[model samples]
Target: MENLPKKVRSKKLNTRVDLTAMVSVSFLLIIFFMVVGELSKPKIMDLSLPHNDDGRISCGPMREGENRSITVILDKNNRLIYYMGLLDSPIIAPKEIQYGKEGIRKELLSRKQNILGYSSRNLKPENIIVIIKPSKKSNFKNLVDILDEMAIAKIETYAIVPEFTPEEYKLLALK
Candidate 1:
């Protein structure tokens, strides 16, 4: 018998995979994480706070007709501890520290009002200087909170003791 023409044998099988659903799920997960991520916090350290051009150790002398400055300190626990250099005693303690924006705002407002009443002085809150002293162990979140409070209080100049890098120290030493 004559050999019939042999048909070509097909040995390879083709498989297709659709990645559209996977890509959509990945996109959704990325969006979810982005929205849920923690907010950035400010940096806090124990370095000596900055001084004014004058040789004053702390807040400078208030300008004429100016209200006293508000000096707040943050302890290791990130609490709102404070000492008003002008006041005879401490106004706020570590335990009094609260995390809410409104809470801080209220504290600042009350302090401003109280200061105005003292010494028969009619001082505007804007004239007060808010000094922030955040400890090294304190979290950056706490620093940011205090800064926000100061801004809300409408204080123009604020002071922070920034930790100097090695290079900065060298430069300062030279000068």
Candidate 2:
């Protein structure tokens, strides 16, 4: 028995895991996450701010016809009140319009066409200016809707005026 050669055996490994599949799966998961992150971006609106002191001054007092201005007032309960020209003596009476495609959008399109027609006939074309006023009772959604309408109507000039005059309050109260 001592003369017999001793047999040597190889030790077996406890774990035999193939890391190739796991590495490929991890790479695929990373790629999927990266692609999803790039595809889910928020849409943002571009806004322009007014200059502090632009050295540009009016040559003369604004002509009554040249001032194609409209004021849009957003009140509570989804009510919209708009008037043409100055609030002191609006060319058109304070009219009430609802919020949506059929209401405010239609009104804006009609007004824009009217202004465009007048502008084309005049020697100098004047783009319409819209003044947006949101009351305390109005919510953020209303403000956002008005801004979206401005964009949809292709309105280039607009301003947000926070103050509401006594007359405007009375007008809103009437509705």
lDDT leader:
2
Model 1 over residues 1-175: C-alpha lDDT tens digits?
4698888999997688989999999999998887667444455788754354565555545443223556565655556555444333333322245656556677777767776664233556565667776656578888888787777776676788655335423323342
Candidate 1 has its poorest 10 consecutive residues by lDDT at 86-95
Kindly report which residue stretches of model 2 are placed more than 4 angstroms away from their true locations once superposed: 1-61, 116-126
Q: What lDDT is obtained when candidate 1 is compared to the true structure? A: 0.60
Which one wins on TM-score? Answer: 2
Clashes of 1: 1
Q: Which runs in model 1 stand beyond 4 Å of their true positions?
A: 1-67, 86-95, 119-121, 162-175
TM for every model, in the order presented, reads 0.45, 0.59
